[model samples]
Target: QPANKVFPHFVPSLSGFSLTSEVKTQDVEYDVPKANSTDGKDEVLFGAEKGWLGTPIDELNRMPQCAPPLSHLKVVPNHTVTVRTDLLREGEVPVPYPTKFKDAWDDVSVKMPCSEKNLFPMETEDGGGVQSRWELIHTALQGGFKKRSHLTILLLQCLFFPTLSSLQCLELCEAQHLFEVVLPAMVSLALSAPRLCTLPIPLLKSRMNHSLTMSQEQIACLLANAFFCTFPRRNSRKSEYCNYPEINFYRLFEGSSSRKIEKLKTLLCYFRRVSQIRPKGLVTFTRQMVNNPPNWESSQTQLTRLHITCEGTIEDDGYGMLQVDFANRFVGGGVTGHGLVQEEIRFLINPELIVSRLFTEAMEYNECLIITGTEQYSKYSGYAESYKWKESHTDETDDWQRRCTEIVAIDALKFRHFLEQFLPEKMVRELNKAYCGFFRSNTNSKHLSAVATGNWGCGAFGGDTRLKALIQLMAAAEAGRDMAYFTFGDAQLMRDVHEIHTFLTGRKVTVGRLYSLLNQYSSTVCKNCRTTRPDESLYSFIYQKVSSQTATDALKVISDGTDTKNLW
Candidate 1:
């Protein structure tokens, strides 16, 4: 009988608090990458040699995504362009490609809607919006920087953006600092890098099938707003923006340590890059979720082949395939949290993924978020607090689009109690989650590649490494996709998983049959060891039931440890 049929009674309640369940709420915050605030404490500037004051993000000003040339391109008003990330052939969509920054900027700027005379809602009967906005900006500067001499100059310098002509007549300081200090700084930084006017058309077309292109200037403006701590609706406890990753410049302002200085230097470097160089390519964010996706019990798909390895990181080894991000249920787990992990690393490298938090609500088990064409900004050497931004990363793009990497986020469940995962219902839920992520649409399946994953839930989530590995394997089989499993640094798992896969593949066992075996194993094993931990591992236990009687010799070989080297 199929596992579902015989193990019908083994399906536990999908939603119930177990003995290990505990509610956690954090009042403490961490100073991590991209932590910004409008409280004036996390100011984005410094004085002279040690000044943390705002530096001109020239790239954002120059490459506004919604600015003129492409501004005329019809899209949902106020929303950036949305495009598919699936692979596409050359010349499929005929859109004008500008080869110079000036041309594109002028074209788009001409189409920019005229700003309402009453732009600020809080404007008085007189024209006080500009002054009011300035006060708001001035007030958000860190306390020490809020003093007169430092404050006026910083405000004037910030107004150096070409779009803010409204501040021209403001009687702040004489134009000396604004013109000589700030304008020159901004211009020097902008001119230092080549203008990103031209699109890497050939490379973009060849690499990704579809994408959403945003102007670098637009990105710069957003970052500038973040840097100045001017973004509104970002500070409340139950903020509308809470679902989104924190984008304001709050966390960087929360400290005076060497780490914060190092981060500041890196942040300045990023702004400098944005100001000087226009990206030679485009970026696309695509959220892939299967519609009417299959349930585990009814799945009949076969596993695509895979390669299991012990050493190497997922980003480096699994460059082109849809790499998996072991995410939190909320997505981008504690990326801003004090403790860093794989998901945090992924977010740091492709900072663009953080934008998904703006619109994406908490993730359900069967949903997955995918991103394509996000560039990596910093290179780091270690994990977590030991993680340091080593240097700027310039990835190659011409023939292969730059940052045309694809990442799918699949959040593994956090079992409060280790044994709760053994329940058949939980296993089925995990299977469905993985299958939704792994199953490529019929049209894209031929071109879609296998998945790269490892130690996904083995870290902070308290998941059993072996069990998680098996769940991923079964899901891949159901989706008919190959998998490249990265054990991160776990060498032993590399061996044991290889043996288990080899054993299963050799038997030519179908997923339905494996489900049946898993069901039988869980029920029998749980009944026998209700009070104490099983003496045997789950893998050994499952093997004992599935192949022990028929392949007793194989079991003996594994148990003896003499046949370990050539299991595959």
Candidate 2:
């Protein structure tokens, strides 16, 4: 059974509340400190330099060098693309060879009409008729279809054009441009797949900092093949790709839902934009792992800087910072399915990210995937079930080494029992996972940027927001990065987090102290039947304990005759 369905909602209590407990109905406003101008150099934040793009590409462990050897390519030109038909073999020579083409068509066949096949006549201009969408796609794949084929235009029209009653002039024009210009060019690019993917794409395996860099054209070609559902052994769980996320467009095209339609609109928009102007920049995907775990109780790392707010989103306001993706262990999560949360929406706008699922293995607990240089193509409104594609977005963010944006994907644990999260072992697991994502070994310590994150693992994963905020805070501080926390419109959470952060920083709290406090709190909760009392919350406990400890320290100092004059 799914964990979410099994766990009851567990709300924390706040007894002995010394802090302001009144929940604010209105949005709380806070000012984010601006970075001082660096005269075209990297900005500095909290005594550390901002952004990692200035670091050399080679130094970052990026693959597919500026000029990679063609011999490393598994799908070279004038050769057959050898799809991995089984698990990767040890000591095997990965290469492409001539072979017969085999199609692994699934139940969701593309033969069905974009609309209803029976609704329109199938007659063509050449005194013949097209039977199915597959025929057109197959012809294009074999390089026999004309760019101006009327049948292709009709199919595209059926796919994109809405019913006449609701079709506006602008929508019609966009659809017209897509079918007439963008799609044909993309189909042509797909035909040249052999040349575009000339470099051997390495699988970003577990426990490694393996990076793969591919040009935008190469990504487009790969996506084009996905659109055509040309990749073999990818449609079924019985195939070798059973361990990988689905890459073909069959599932996207075959489904019927308002959610699916909106996703399709977003994808079509991405294809249209890329087809018109092929991007020249390169994107890198790196799988990062942490072999040596931190000793949470003994570490003396100080809390880094923090900027917490209830307004704005991680992607929008957190620009130039290392953005966090509340992801599934499967990488792209449910972008290809019904999911429309933070990670899925991100993948849709930046469709290039979808390519990572092709070679990225299912992540381990100590692993995270970092993607840099991918551009956004669409804007969106609403979330989850209410998600809608708003319009095209033009990104003007500056790039370093042809890379602009950076995102780190981390999967949080899904708790089966609500109280299980309070266990010491579970809390430690979360800290290490967040630390792995935030840590940057390739760059100098002074060059690490702040992390932009929100209520990670708090939504469907059932993580307590207050606890998660603190966990990420400790992890970021240990990794030597500051943080900007967005509450996703939770005003009360934002205020509470801000107050706690101010208290910790003002008290000169160390990471070790914080970790010890967390364990103490866990022990208290366990002693009380593994559930917090209605009047007892993590915040109140920390506030009361820290206050008591500070008072005791002052008393001790006075008794020892240290600063007695000041105490009097």
Candidate 3:
């Protein structure tokens, strides 16, 4: 895992908010020939050892088409005492942790310090006077949070104020007997500490490898630390740590809507389970990249055959394979805001992935993220704003001691103007980004599974469905992988994509030809409609051009073995 010199790491900007330069590939180095071609003037060629119009192309033959078996990979979980609690039922209701929660905390508290002063203020000026941690938590829960009722209150206490007495706040607990056994040990741990609960220093550092493996218990601890708002200086906007994504639980407490409360129930339910059970195996957050990204203009790769469907999710469709997340540059994508998309849904399900934000810097266009071994703690059904976290389930681990999951975060460019995305440079930028994310394994090894993605940047980013789909297909082909595209209920997109793909496949169109056509098509459209027009779709244009008898005859004439001299 050596660094590629061609893609040198870019330093963060002064504000520490955005990338200042191009992104560098992490932990991977591979040899690529230098091309002599200048930008825009060089002739583009595919499958040429001499290099595609001076833009060097790595030999695809050496790259593996499929990933190596899990047994061959080593994924070790960080050492932490696991708390077992699998007996809890899953449904609409939130459940408290097992009675063993306090005992587990007591065992760990010996190594960790406790707070000498009160964790919360004794009283609030605007509200009824609260005297203790238990009372404050109780009062917070009393405002008609009826989703899981008593279990919610009890779990909140265990998560935030581990040492708060259940007996002392018996009125808050509608079922006093349920938490009596867990409260004593929990209170002892809370009274012992007011300092921030933090991760081990080594675990928090940003490294070249950019890979971190944590046990379920460790993830629980990190999240619980956030729950208590114990992470020092995290709450302040001006804090040095403000550059990092928000990890504290302050946002959840800001509003009192039922939807917000439901979100809380989902989060606590996960905590309750982790507090009780030590999940087996580990999860790894590894940021990945293409060591020598291909210049898309010169790539001659063919569109790897795709399975286009309007149904299913990326996780479900691409199971046991690498699943792509259309992430924001900062990752997690407004999980703390009102926005909810695939990224948010993925985070809500596999909450551990959210912790990657703690160290992951804002990504550049060429950068993509790879997360392995994240366990899904909850189930959900719905898209975007309607998404609901439903039921609890255990993720089975693979032979390599990793969870049976691999997610790559590939952020699409966000265009303020619709026409901006049609520019050739923008398309090339997207092609590189998608290829970087799709190109799995290294030069010596390959993970050949098809990518599962669809409607990627089309939603919030305002990308053309047909155009983005083609871009993704080209990138996947260049990466030596097929694609399983989930249209996510966009029937027209599914139909258009299928027709275009069918036509292209029938003509045996290489990626280079389509790319050339894309460039031509983009240029033509821009000229045809100076103003942004929705009717002139890339799919319709391609279909008309490729399906024409003249175009077919031209294709037959140009077909001369592997080398089609006339790209136009």
Candidate 4:
């Protein structure tokens, strides 16, 4: 017999009022990524020191994935390319954030199909839409960055939530900032609900003397909207040294108001409520957290980032050194993992519910995080249902849990082979002839005459050799080709290793009848000598005849999945 059946669960008291059961209408506004179906008028953005800005992203200058070029061929983004931090990748579908258009934004508004492109959210043109602000708020809140949910939750609380008794572990300061205005209101609120420990005592007394008409939710939302703020870092001096201004991507921005960070931080205090107030001057606070205990297992997770940047150093045998000083100006981010579960949503968990959701979501995603939540449950429950538990049949959850750890690890070999295809038949001869006097890095100067090939070595995370290989190919291949192609076997390894496929395969696709799309290399390579002709060609005959290459039909291993196409 189940223990649950015998004892049953003790139900919490809802009579005094619990937010879980409240039915306040939610405001719906934010959009999801790449959801537009019909085309909107596109904008023609210009290239400058900074990137382009527009009204809607889904329609205007949106970029698609392309095949990675052979390592010798340089990859370059064209006028049609638009890469933003909020990027949508292959296999990751977009869901619209169900918010109303009137909620925000000035120039663009969402209609039929929407993604995270525009801001002013409105009712669905589909009519009777089920979108809600709660969904948008909570969903984004749950997305945790660098495994820190508090950052996201704190930001959200600053933006949306108002006075509450307590939030997780934050204390509600009840000394009364707005004494005359809030005191009577708090007293009246307490008198009506004696069980509520959150109401500030002074506010209630003031409410008895004067009238306060706003509901808690209404007041909270109003305050949240009025205080919409931002905290953007100043453009740095580094940009002046380079061709552009130094821009920081991760700084928080709240609409048009970009200078009010301190105010926003202060506003965060209102969301928390004190559990008790002592007569002599003591105030007690209660924590409102998910019901899960934190432990090692629940909090762990795996992450894969697909970074594409220029490589080559300031050293060379011919031109002295390539002279390109590289700095960690974090840019060009792609959604390289499952967006929701692996993102901010985990932080919103009530302290008690954190572990359960961590494991449940892990099971759902076929991967467990090494988070405190997951570990706590695993330790207390002894991995009973974990896939690693083993005695029972392996469910999707267990398999994923087992595999995520394995998958998170790096593979240093795969992409390196892809880079090999670019080397000239006579390695030393090619370096002397083909390479520009400049180079990127040169820890090993004896082999390649390139500059800036030396490792600056800033990143703290472990390296994925395969990821490095892909980067090498990307760095080397970016010079000559307008487009690229990396063909590989049809497997998850070919796919989940995201950086390889993204720059190499995803984006810029058009599905055709079964025969997979073609990849162009602007030049041809001789099958016998593996020599690449710098000249561009459309057909094998034109390329082979002029270049005098053999007719060996070497396999063009497209790392891009079978379903994609590119133009230039």
Better of 1 and 3 by lDDT: 3
Best by TM-score: 2
lDDT of 3 at 155: 44
**Candidate 3 residue-wise lDDT, 493-566, digit = tens:** 65567557756765667788778778877788865676766467777777677668446676777674444444
Tell me the lDDT of model 2 at 503.
Answer: 72
TM-score per prediction, in order, is: 0.63, 0.72, 0.66, 0.18
lDDT of 1: 0.51
Alpha carbon deviation, residue 177, candidate 2 (Å): 3.8
Residue 522 lDDT, candidate 2, scale 0-100: 79
How much is 515 displaced in model 1, in angstroms?
2.5
Where is model 4 more than 4 Å wrong at Cα?
A: 1-47, 50-56, 60-176, 179-503, 506-568
Better of 1 and 2 by TM-score: 2
Candidate 3: segments with Cα more than 4 A from true spot = 1-67, 70-209, 443-446, 547-568
- Residue 500 in candidate 3, Cα distance off native in Å: 0.9
What ordering of candidates by TM-score runs from best to worst?
Answer: 2, 3, 1, 4
Best by lDDT: 2
- Models, CA RMSD each: 19.0, 13.7, 16.1, 27.2
Q: What are the per-residue Cα lDDT tens digits for candidate 2 across 371-428?
A: 9878788777778877766667766423223345789999999986667787899999
